[model samples]
Target: MSESTTPLVWLVIRKDDNGNRYRIGSYATKAEAQQIADRLDDRGPKQLYWVERAGQGGAQ
Candidate 1:
């Protein structure tokens, strides 16, 4: 997908091919995303990611 479709800042993680989740979430910003990534990484087990790309969908 192009960068347009993909937001400049998004939830990135070490997940499987498909969006298979298996951990904590609710990150609303780039900083929050990075914070969660680091926290989870230290905890180990490579829990599935829960990255909800903000700004893509919402009710006006």
Candidate 2:
């Protein structure tokens, strides 16, 4: 498939204590994004990590 046609449907987002959100990375699969988010979440509790659809509202 072409790069433009391949959808990056998964987004890994991080939110800090100040309530600011950032898009850490994008992945073609939810499982891949979730694994990265889970690993980051485990490293510390100061920040929060989660996965959502790319255009849903979590992150862009």
Candidate 3:
């Protein structure tokens, strides 16, 4: 298990009924991410994906 001392928040927002669904979040693992997804109201055909960090770069 990949455990991070720092906690993160997961978010899913849709622009409208006709518009596409947008998945946004900050999470340490997929287990935590799935928890957040289960709490949402399903009203569309869109899916959710994770957003990864792109920093600390090749420099590290």
lDDT of 3 by residue, 1-60 (tens): 335666554433333455554545556655666655555534346444333332311111
Best by TM-score: 2
> Which one is best on lDDT?
2
Q: What lDDT tens digits, residue by residue, belong to model 2 across residues 1-60?
A: 887787888999998888889999988889999999989988966688899996699532
Name the lDDT of candidate 2. 0.87
Per-model TM values vs. the true structure: 0.38, 0.81, 0.37
Residue 36 miss distance in model 1 (angstroms): 1.1
Error of 2 at 18 (Å): 0.3
Return the lDDT, model 2, position 11.
90
Q: Please, what is the whole-model Cα lDDT of each candidate in the order they appear?
A: 0.54, 0.87, 0.45
Ranking by lDDT: 2, 1, 3
Kindly list the per-residue Cα lDDT of model 1 for residues 1-60, writing each as its tens digit.
664564445554456546454334444467777777777677756555444455443221
Off by over 4 Å in 2: 2-5
Provide the RMSD of all predictions against the true structure, rounded to 1 decimal: 10.5, 2.9, 7.9
